[model samples]
Target: MIAMTALAGPPADTLWATSLRRWNALCWVLFAMMAVGLATMDGPAGSRYTALALLGSVVLCYAVLDRFPDNPAIRPHVYLSVLAVALGGLAYLRSNYAALFMVTLPHYWMFGRTPRASMGFLGLATVGTVAGSVLRQDGWTVEFFSETVVSTLIVVAVGVLIGLWAHSVVAQSTERARLIVELEQTQAQLSEAHQRQGAADERERLAREIHDTLAQGFASIIVLAEAARAGLDSDTARSAQQLRSIESTARENLAEARELVGSAHRPGQTAAGSVARTLRRTLNRFTEDTGLTVDAELTDLVCDQQTRIALLRCTQESLANVRKHARASTVGVVLTRQAHGVELEITDDGTGFVVEESTGFGLDGMRKRLAELGGRLTVTSSVGDGTRVLALIPMAFEAPGEGEAER
Candidate 1:
């Protein structure tokens, strides 16, 4: 006849509250059956009626407390006190009623707010039941001692052990729930951090693309337009030639802009040919635009598309720097296939500045691009001397798609 209480674990949800309600219903059924049996049993009329009144009072108190669980005025300890008193009075009326004391054990554990409080109420209930039964016999008797006192002590000892075990189970369940919540929160934060890092990498890539392609084309157009205007009063044919060059540069710039925005082939992807032919075409264009003497030795090499693109970009950036600041007349480009990989070297006999002091974005961009391809760039120059830009790339580098899939 042990009663059950609300399980102390995670916060009560709809399912948990529903289960608790069902348990309360079962307790009510047991109490109702006990009341009916007591009414039918034969006994002294006065004692029977008094015991019935006490049972009715206990039922009323339990019902009120259960209905208003959160009411500050109706406390659990008050209901336990009334229950203990009724159990003792019933046991005194008829020694047979001492059996009901066993059924009362769980009520103390269920209603008491703490372990110490529950133990206190349990002890009080046991003493009350045993004392009343002993007094009803009017003297010390072995039958009363064996049935009432000994059995009550055994029940109390077993109930204490069960209560302690239930408390430990609830404690472990609560701790596990707390750890699960913390783990979910940590995973969410890691996901957000990864997204932020991805966005930043994308922005850096776009900035480098704009600097290498569209920015250089626009510079070419500006220079060509100014040259055409200057030569118009002196030579009409040459002025017309310069104007055509401007138009050609403007058109190339437009195509580069569309590719960057449309997410189609990137800027260097449109340059169709081997790495050698690509550098040859770029050198020819530089000579045409700047009228600088160019000595080029290129080797037709086999490599990945990204390697070709990186070499082309490095060549373009080096020539741009020479055109803007080198003030050199002869530009030399040499592309050779080594044992490990391909190498591209561009040297200009121009007035160069100290490499360490230069903070231009073009050089930094080239270094970052080559590094991404498992390559490196080395620039050697000094004041009044020419600058040499060399780029080296590994041949065994993974393709972009293959590398991503493996990860």
Candidate 2:
């Protein structure tokens, strides 16, 4: 009875707290009503104080809930049906608000006990209700007994059904709230994953651009600086020429870096100079700077501007790796025409790395550039042996005197 009234109105923080407050209030209020009503009435002390004694039983039952210890050896639900049965026995002595209180008392049974125990408690309350009605009567008759019993049974049946349905609704609402919380957590994790993936993709794009332009440019500068150092005392003109080359490479590197990151500056037209002559000059300058001997066989091959650029970039990257890691005194350079395509092979007799062990971004950049143009790179190396880099590009051969090549 107290548990039902314990439910709060709109002001309480939660339903459970309201129920507790209402339950505590109802127990004391019923005790006070019995105390005041019996005392004020023209009744014998036994009848007057006896009602307080009856209500005191209920107060004792409430004390179990009201002053429950923080950590209990036994669960509260285990004894709740026992408390309900005791309260029903006391409500029988006098027909107070406790009789009407039996209507919603099924809620506590349903909450604290299983279905069978709850049904059993309802039956107990029903018996108490019938007995209390019989006690209040002036005389006993079958007609009066049958009418009251049948009507009370009907009301109890309705109240039990309502309690079961209410419990079902609360259970479903709790489960739905749990599912909503899980879905929100999943969405937050998915959003964070997308953010991380986007960041990784941007980093990879920047790495490719840097490997192609800045890394190659820096390698050239190192070689030229070494050359200038060698020529400082012997030949001023050669040193001056090396310095000029260094400056030119730096400026070009800046321009390429800017363009790679999205600038309006595009690289100048390469068709104005023979691609063969440009490669030859770059290789000669590389040999002059490093004092490395080169036995070269060159042939004029026609290809698109993009192919030419890719080939140049690949060659620069390959040579840069050799200059940085190779301790070889002699290197091999070969460019030749296959039946339907061109191949550039650069081999060095230096300490080579195991192919499977090497995972440099420079190699990945070279592979990406070739893959873009339907070209391929093949590397062969083993520890203590020389490394060989081969770039093969399938392209239509342009005839001599053709002003521009098709992309």
**Mind giving the per-residue lDDT tens digits that candidate 1 earns over 12-56?**
688877777777778777866776587558877888788888888
C-alpha local distance difference test of each model: 0.81, 0.67
Q: Model 2: runs farther than 4 Å from truth?
A: 1-45, 56-87, 95-98, 106-124, 127-141, 198-210, 233-236, 251-358, 365-407
TM, every model: 0.77, 0.56
lDDT of 2 by residue, 256-357 (tens): 787676622444443533445546766776676567766555566666667777777777787777778887667777777777587878888888888888
- Write out the backbone clash pairs for model 2: 6-19, 6-22
Who wins the TM-score comparison?
A: 1
The deviation in Å at residue 243 for candidate 2 is: 2.2
Distance from true position, residue 139, model 1, in Å?
A: 5.7
